[model samples]
Structure formats: structure tokens, C-alpha cells
Target: MNLNLRHAVISNVSGNNQGQLQDTIVDAIQSGEEKMLPGLGVLFEVIWQNADDQDKQEMLATLEQGLKK
Candidate 1:
């Protein structure tokens, strides 16, 4: 059997609107549970895929800054 994690994640959240998506993301993050990590990873993957060079650089810089702190 094969599983498509990204597609599955997207399908799961497909019905959500902007506010609900925000709530889902916020809830997953603030809960700080291991199980939520995969969902967050999938979300990040989507963001990274759609990001432009400047956006990607900014994201990397933000990550670097956060990591430094």
C-alpha cells in the first residue's frame, strides 16, 4: 500500500476557509504535540513550494533569526 501524505493533508483541510485554516494552524502549533508536526510540515511544504526567491530568502532569514534567538 502506498500513502500520499501531502495529498492526504490537503484533502483533509480542503474544506477549510481562511479563518478555519488559521485556527487549525494556530491550534496545531500552540498545542505543541508531536502528532501535529506532520501537518505543520505539510503546511510548510505548500508555503515553500509557492514561495518566490525573495520570499524564500526572507523565510530563511527569519528562520535563521529565530534560531539565533
Candidate 2:
């Protein structure tokens, strides 16, 4: 999706707390809930977009690792 939409989803998931968003996203991922994937993708896009170079690299690396499992 577009960046704006991605940010909006992240903002919604964040619900006024940046820290909680990460945990929520991770929980969704670990839970293996197919319904949550789209929303998670939006959040991931937002995180990928806003993350610094090193963070983006690490995030992508982690995602790649997850997909291998």
C-alpha cells in the first residue's frame, strides 16, 4: 500500500504509544493469524519506512529469517 495508508495503520496500531505498537505487531506475527497479516504488513511498511539505515537492515534481516521458518 501507499506510505500514507501504511502510516495511518501504524498510528492506529500504536494507539498513542509507539512502544506498544511493536509488541502488538510481534504478537500478531507470533500468533500466526492470517487475518492480521495485512495489517501487519502495513505496520511493517511503516516501520521499514521510518527506521534508520541500520534498523531497516536489521528489520529486513529478521523478516527474512522468519519467512525461512
Candidate 3:
């Protein structure tokens, strides 16, 4: 079977409002389930691909800050 998880994940969340997207992210993080990691990673990949340079920099800064602790 051929599976494209990134495409599937993005499709699953397509058309979601900001609040709904936020809820999905928050729920996934709060659940702390290993399975959710892939979903989060797919979401991040989407974000990374579309983010502008400033946004990418901000994300990198946030990631660095997160790793510092």
C-alpha cells in the first residue's frame, strides 16, 4: 500500500479555522502520545515549507530556546 502521511495529515486539517487548528495542536501536545508525533511533524513540515524567512527565523529561535532549557 502506498501512503503519503504528510499529504494525509494536511488534508485532515484542511479548512480548519485558527481556533480549530490551535485546538488540534494543543490536544496533540497535551496528550503526549507517541503516535501524535508524526502528525505534529507533518504539520511542522507544512509550516516550514510555507513560512517566510522571518517566520522561519522565528521558528528556529523558538526551537533553539526550547532546546536550551
TM-score, per-candidate, Cα-based: 0.86, 0.58, 0.90
Window of ten residues with lowest summed lDDT in model 1: 1-10
Preferred candidate (lDDT higher): 2 or 3: 3
lDDT of 3: 0.91
Q: Which ranges in model 2 have alpha carbons more than 4 Å from their true place?
A: 1-8, 67-69
Residue 55 Cα positional deviation in candidate 2, in Å, after optimal superposition: 1.4
Worst 10 residues of 2 by lDDT: 10-19
State the lDDT of candidate 2 residue by residue for 29-60, as single tens digits.
Answer: 89998877888778666667889999988987
Colliding residue pairs in candidate 2 = none
Q: Tell me the lDDT of candidate 1.
A: 0.89
| Between candidates 2 and 3, the TM-score winner | 3
Over 4 Å off, model 1 = 1-3
Give lDDT tens digits, candidate 3, residues 1-69: 125887788899999999999999999999999989999998898899999999999999999999999
Q: For all candidates, what are the clash counts?
A: 0, 0, 0
Which candidate number would show the highest TM-score if scored against the true structure?
3
lDDT ranking of the models: 3, 1, 2
Model 2 whole-model lDDT (C-alpha atoms): 0.77
